[model samples]
Target: PSVKSVIQGFLPGLALKIFLIMLPKLIMAMSKMEGYTSFSSLERRSASKYYLFVLVNVFLGSIVTGTAFQQLEQLINQPSSE
Candidate 1:
């Protein structure tokens, strides 16, 4: 099997999971840093920061997922040549 398609397919799923996990943490961190406590305050902070988090997560997750797929391909497919 060609490693290229596997890498592409694996990356999007990994990136999505990474985005889901990272987004809330990113929002909470930014909210706390800005001293937001109440629901409204946090909502406002999260509203703005969440978009930034999405952007950041997309970039970072793509990089990470791509790297992970590359490593996976190598580990799975690299033959023990004579």
Candidate 2:
């Protein structure tokens, strides 16, 4: 109940989640305009952008009353038996 109550308090996170999902595609579109000389370079740029997105979303997000770390904690707490 306590966790559920905390999760239910924030609503805008849904929109942020949606934007993050689409971020990679957005990076690809911009990469096309940049005209990279090699396919690997384009892929690398897109990957860098995606990682930056996650880094900001995880590290900076924790500064707020967000669930990023909570989910991380849940993942870390799982048994290694799996």
Candidate 3:
């Protein structure tokens, strides 16, 4: 395959990887802002945030194309049965 084609594949997966890593840390930071009284609260907050991210990805992945956003247009026009 051409370099351009390889790069196109690499970039999205790279962005998703970055997002996955950053998301939990972002939640961790935000949780501390509220001065969480217990470790359990912080842990629960992080898990909930991560779960939301995974839920969105799993739902959208069903309509996968070269990239997630590209499939959204197709899904929008698709009939419910699909």
lDDT of each: 0.80, 0.80, 0.80
Clashes of each: 0, 0, 0
Better of 1 and 3 by TM-score: 3
Q: Residue 50: error of model 1 in Å? A: 1.3
Comparison by lDDT, 2 against 3, better one: 3
- lDDT by residue for model 1 (1-82), tens: 5799988889879978887777777787778887877988787778777777667767887799899999999988996678
**lDDT by residue (tens digit), candidate 3, 16-71:** 88888888888888888979868899999889978986877755565564477666
**Considering TM-score, where higher is better, how would the candidates rank from best to worst?**
3, 2, 1
Worst 10 residues of 1 by lDDT: 49-58
| TM-scores, all models, native as reference | 0.46, 0.53, 0.62
Where model 2 places Cα greater than 4 Å from the true spot, the runs are 1-10, 61-82
Kindly list the per-residue Cα lDDT of model 2 for residues 1-82, writing each as its tens digit.
5877767765567767888889888998888889976878988999998899788866676766466677778889984575
